[model samples]
Target chain A: QTASPAVAKPSRLGLCASCHGETGMAVMPGAPNLAGQRLDYLRQALKDYRDGRRDAPVMRAAIGPIGAAELDALARWYSAQAPAAASAP
Target chain B: QTASPAVAKPSRLGLCASCHGETGMAVMPGAPNLAGQRLDYLRQALKDYRDGRRDAPVMRAAIGPIGAAELDALARWYSAQAPAAASAP
Candidate 1:
């Protein structure tokens, strides 16, 4: 399938997937899942990171360059993905 | 002081602040704000909407009876609040 621009291009979601995993399932202790997140919620988060509302040194830098369109795509992609299986390891 | 139990009980970020307000912003138009997100990405989006793996049927019944120390006190009170400034309305 032809991935959307957000999916095809490097996006904030991609940055998130770097640690949160491609499906929003956090692979590490600190990362978190983005899969199935509310699009509105996700959008706001990206905006937060970009606008310096949220505080995450890495996240701010990560989401800094992202734009609205990309953020929307990211949100849609993650929101559509299935939530990762729960496993407390 | 004392507002800890996920901001004094009633979590899921207080039902997403009854519509993503209370700091997270997102007054309307799909609601998204959540000021200063990122507490491990809000604890994997409340464990992917309580293990359904993300799909928002009203956020899986509103995080389906949240736990995990109230989602880490609502991801450390919306990652310490702040964000919420940009307006697209």
Candidate 2:
């Protein structure tokens, strides 16, 4: 599925960019860098949000309206991005 | 803050564990493995969901009620966990 501007606009993932950065890197404290993250894992996360198996009011709301096709596009987009320099000390 | 049973229970991140596997690995298709992921990155993702920047409807809902403290705990939990075998083929 292709990510349309209306569908995949940064607004959808804008809050994500705050900590995940525009490219999925952790730009803030306590956030995990998502650049170069595995596609399988990203997809599962989207599913978890949809199923309500995971608990996070904010996450559930963000992913509430998205469909599987869009989720796939998001996973692919973030997974394909390069990871930021390892901040692990 | 410590992860309480009601607070930091797997239910909150349960859906995440599915593709992320119990250990944050990508056990399913289109998911990204989060094991061994940077703690900073995870925190950012939670924030994104809370802020509505990310486009996944499911994720926003999942992270809706989570506070920063809990988000930190979740990030630490996943980041500290070991990553499963790389499926990056």
For lDDT, the strongest prediction is 2
Against the native complex, each candidate's DockQ, computed on alpha carbons, is: 0.11, 0.23
Clashing pairs in 1: A24-A33, A24-A34, A40-B32, A53-B83, A54-B36, A83-B53, B11-B14, B24-B34, B24-B35
Docking class of 1: incorrect
Residue A13 of model 2: what lDDT? Answer: 70
Instruction: Give the per-residue lDDT of model 1 (tens digit) for A1-89.
Output: 12233344334555677776776555666655555456666777777777776556677667767777887777677655544333222
Cα displacement (Å) at residue A70, model 2: 1.7
Q: Candidate 2 chain A: minimum summed lDDT over ten consecutive residues — where?
A: A1-10
- Model 2 chain B: weakest 10-residue lDDT segment is B1-10
Clashes of 1: 9
User: Over the stretch A1-89, how does candidate 2's per-residue lDDT look in tens digits?
Assistant: 12223324444577667656667656766655566677666777778778875556766766776787778877766676654333461
Which 10-residue span in candidate 1 chain B carries the lowest summed lDDT? B1-10
Best by DockQ: 2
